[model samples]
Target: MRTREEQQSDPYPTTVEIHCLNQFLMEDWDEEWDRISEELEEQDIPVPEGYYEIQKQILDLHQDMSVVEILESEEDDDGEMWYTIIDVEEQKIHPGMPRYALMFADKPYSTDIFLDNVFRHDMRVPDSLFPQTWKNRQAAKYQNM
Candidate 1:
């Protein structure tokens, strides 16, 4: 897992690479987004454009309205991280999930800003989770099915 500090070293400050696992419900997406936005605002975090693009890609892929998960690395255990699953249709985050991270990979922004936003919220991606490359592979596999 890449540390927030390392990600900040890049030219882009606020960009994240997300692995979209599944589709989420549109109805709940707004409510969940509101909650996420509120949390960021409270912490003074600004997500880059790339983050939104990743989210848009997921949304486009899953038009039926589904839920998505964001996995973060755990601080205490390098092997484990946290997962925040949001139900787009309900527009609310699933219980026992962490807050959403801003700046999806496809979005336009710098890594520095992305790391800044993540650090501002004290967030981390879990090492146990799949990398973006793996996720893309899985997505492609399913596309042919």
Candidate 2:
């Protein structure tokens, strides 16, 4: 888990750990991705870089994913990388399963901690309550370079 101070400083961070993931979640991850990739290539579909990471961050922000426990990708037998997002306050991923199961690995990608639009335009963020901002918002908007 990361502290708020940490997130505020760099909301978009990169990681490749398979933290706290279930075996069932990533049953045949590598094969699935390989198949998908081949299919996309055959169709001449442009493969988006940082594909998995971008999707995970979007899901997190949209569902307000709380905290994650990582198991690191290289440690598993199938190299089965996985992680579980848990609500630190409640200590559960909604008292059962998480909002979604996601696959990650291969290419490095930037992931958001929470607030979307805080980083990559390539990322996704659903509609949600926004924090009141002063001129800092304008300052940030202009500071982007």
TM-score for all models, in order of appearance: 0.25, 0.28
Candidate maximizing TM-score: 2
- Clashing residue pairs, candidate 2? 18-71, 18-72, 18-82, 19-70, 19-71, 19-83
The candidate that wins on lDDT is 1
In angstroms, what RMSD does candidate 1 have relative to the true structure?
21.0
Worst 10 residues of 1 by lDDT: 95-104
lDDT tens digits, residue span 1-145, model 2: 3323445665434454323234223346546757988998999998688876786566545532223432121224654433334433445442222223433332234345454657545666533445434345566876685
Q: Give Cα distance to truth, residue 121, candidate 2, Å.
A: 37
